[model samples]
Target: MNRLNMGRACARAGLSLVAMASLSAWAQSGAERLALAAAAPRLSEVVVTAVRAPQPLTDVLADVTLIDRDQIAQSGAVTIADLLARQPGVELSRSGGPGTATSLFLRGAETRFTAVYIDGVRVDSQSTGGAPWEAIALGQVERIEIVRGPAAAVYGSDAVAGVVQIFTRQGDGPFTPYVGIGAGNRRTGKLEAGFSGKQGALDYSLGLQRDMSRGHDSHPGSNPDRDGYRQTAASGRIGLRLNEAHRVDLTGTYTDMDAQYDGFLPGLDDHGLNRLATLGASWTAQWSPAYSTRLSVSESQQRYEMVPTPPYLSRTRLRNYLLQNQWKEGAHTFTGTLERREDHLVNAPIDQGRHQDGLALGYGYVAGAHTVQLNLRHDRDSEFGGQTTGGVAYGFAFAPGWRATAAAGTAFRVPTLYQRFSEYGQPALLPEKGRNVEIGLHWGQAASRLGVTLYRNRVSNLINFGAPGACLSPFGCFENAGKARLQGLTFMAAHQVAGVNLSASLDLQQPKNLATGTLLARRAQRLLKLAADTRVAQWRLGAEWHLASHRWENAANTSRLGGYGLVNLYASTTVARQWDVLVRVDNVGDRSYQLAQGYPALPRSFFVGLRWTGR
Candidate 1:
């Protein structure tokens, strides 16, 4: 791979200081100050995924994106996949429409390289090492933090690409209730209702939602009949403050989905039943203003049943225990965590189980215009023995609103159950290891923010299913015989001018196999996202556009999926004191596209809904 040179861009960015200085002077003259005052209040924007604890985004050294509740509701997105498609340094591929199998590639890395978390608990499947992105409903999410780069030093494994953490919704302020209903193309319908409240020492939130859609043909040539999907999801949380320095919390989520799909060989009416459930409890205590500790436990289960000939059911369960402590003294902070995770898998074709234990240490220091972070961890897996990872990050502020950051980290991923214990399994396969480095620049003012990041990552000891020499033993077996490299640059910008909101992001990447110099599969070299929103009178109008470059569908670059662009429009307005209406048109141009080689994307569609907010 050719080396990347960013000298010219860096020089131009540095030259912008003159313009910023002039703008600063003009702001001090008065009118700009009033404009800032009239602008909406900014959220604190504290992020926890970067450092494993809450810290202001401005002080973090990693490239991170924050998607808050208001943005979720305003985006007119129904699933996590819809919201993630527009993010920087991310690409998605779905086999079909909603509730189907989906894959997320981060910074040109494979789907399994990323680790997903919900309320500080890992949610990826132990059998496949992939998260059920389709089943994670947006209705239960309060916020999402997407941290790009390696994070195995703080989290254990499968964090080579990045870490995506989701915080569930909880009650705040006085009692409030909400309900919504919507209908769209393809006989799609939705119903949702929720209530939230907080008493003197008790806080709680509950939500229920259901959706059904008669989706278009997944593979037109094979099956012309429409595939259908139905899903029901529920989430709840409760917290009790026993005293001023102690608290207890409980949270849970459940989702069930039934989906119809076409088989690879044109078998129609291929159906699947998917179910997921997660429950967690935590106890927190503050030893003083400077010290705190938390103990938590969580359990999660995932099941999938395929119906038709040769029907089978696969189930995986996980139980986790965690103990964490944090201490703050002057300009320095210290943290320590000990965790144990056990995974149990049951399958008609294969049955297996595994356990892992890990310990981590972290340190952070903030003083004047300098910020530094350090982390180290050691994990012992029942099958892979022990491995260690670590990282360091530093940030320095040259001006009031301008800063530069550099980070480097190492990560690893253990082989999945299917890879180790199945019929074609190779129990001797080793874990995959990765190392990465990145440099970033951030500039932000009143209503404007810009972030730039350049990163390179390399992985070795990668496990693959087909190994010529080794496969001879079992006809096809897993082996660690692959090495890959990913290099990329990400640019993100957001600005609020007058009453309009504008945001854009671009990603350029090179993903290659070191052995053959072939491009990786399903990873686009170029991705662009643009969005604009403005409020006129009492109505809010928004538009979004996304463009992706052609990508290879096969690792050898044999089959390719052409690039495509899509546009969407949204409008919302208040109908009454506590009632609001929303309308959205997706794929406004009705363009034909494909995320996968043979699968077809959704066509132009429209939806409208009414929501009531209780006071």
Candidate 2:
């Protein structure tokens, strides 16, 4: 069958699956719902990325997902991108195996549109316009918070799509230490160790990890040799409590990776060396019962280089300083922040630096059955003058278990240094701007929940490479010559039936260029994800299914990439009081698929690990 026919069939199948799941969830009796609710554990989870302040998950008015340490250890994912792909309204594309060039699309927006932060420190590449996903070490991450949709009003630039925050482990409770080792197919091996403890008024955490893998062939047509990767990472955190109302924190992380891949020259061995490092310090003081303040300073550096001939090297350094104040009384909350960011890039003949200073204000109210949030920010750029952004959101609960929400926001992203100072650049390029509006309906009864959201985002002054006329290079130049519209409907459901817990999500979206009327490259129009887990005796078993419709390989939509489906299974059990064992099988059917045009995805793989904790 042709790609178009196949795409249609997949869409129909996804719709049918969604309908069946929704009906099954809604068909449960009131008694069953109550029983499920009673059996479920109550968690008072707090999130900080939604409005840049700590708030209960139940009180936030935005779309968000939180992944704790337990989930991360059970996922058996080799990279951060691999783990994020299973999230709702998110997709990933990679050129090869682990540690390869990767891109993450949030809500069908460009990878560069999303902002990334680690331990409250911003991390971005001025040469590429986004975070270096390949260089980041997932093993060092203790938790992750993802906020989907524009957050520029709270975080200045590079938040046109969303924001991702990664947190390292914190010291708490009694002293504890842990060690883990694992091996998998293709000669993959992993070793990790960590310790955390609290002594007197000080707390500290330290961790180290090493991983190596003999990966599969990335480009069979060009390089027939096996591509492999080696990585080493470390993380540390320290905190001191001076008094009951004052505290100071210090955090840092570093990682080095060497990944082999096929370069343009086929006969020679080629490798990509990547390094990432981040450091941050913060001080918090509670001056009054309802007022608090915090001051922080952070820095991050990223370096990338190619070995042997065809030498290439690029480095990016980012520094951030912030002062934040919060005031709270009963159900009313107010926040104000002053932030400054400096960016520096060095790539061969190009060396440039820029700075942005921003002031932001936010207000939140959660009283009775009503919740509201308002944010506004203004940034002054040394190179581009000034820009302003704002957002407003509201939620109302009219029934016992039902809520309706609506939100609107504006965001912008400044042009990357490479787009304005490199060989093929346009110094007059303009920052891309986006306007978004969304509405949602949600129903929850303990462990059982159902939600539907519709969103429309329009972006103007989109930047793309065009025929060279304003640059010295003869090839092409970056220009703001396009417009795009991203509209979508997302459905999510979770329920407990018998002894099994189930969850599902479906996304139907049209991310298209308004100028040529073509779908965005490598973005599927339909996506579906499903998972179920249950406990038997001492074992916990889970299964996941992922499906996506066909996608276009390029902007013209003439080159078609076929649709595919994948299934994965995992099981974990306690061997001894202090020992844990986990086994996972990915791509159970050994299905052949490709996330990019020339790169083949991994085949069926097996992995097992054992961990021991000292209490």
lDDT of each: 0.80, 0.86
- What digit string (tens of lDDT, one per residue) describes model 2 on residues 432-546? 9999999887766666677777788898999888888789889988989889888787777777788888878888888888888888899998898888888999999999899
Off by over 4 Å in 2: 1-41
**Mind sharing the TM-score for model 2?**
0.95
RMSD of 1: 4.5
Worst 10 residues of 1 by lDDT: 23-32
Best candidate (score: lDDT): 2
Tell me which residue pairs clash in candidate 1.
none
Q: What is the lDDT of residue 119 in candidate 2?
A: 92
What TM-score does candidate 1 reach? 0.93
Candidate 2: lDDT over CA atoms?
0.86
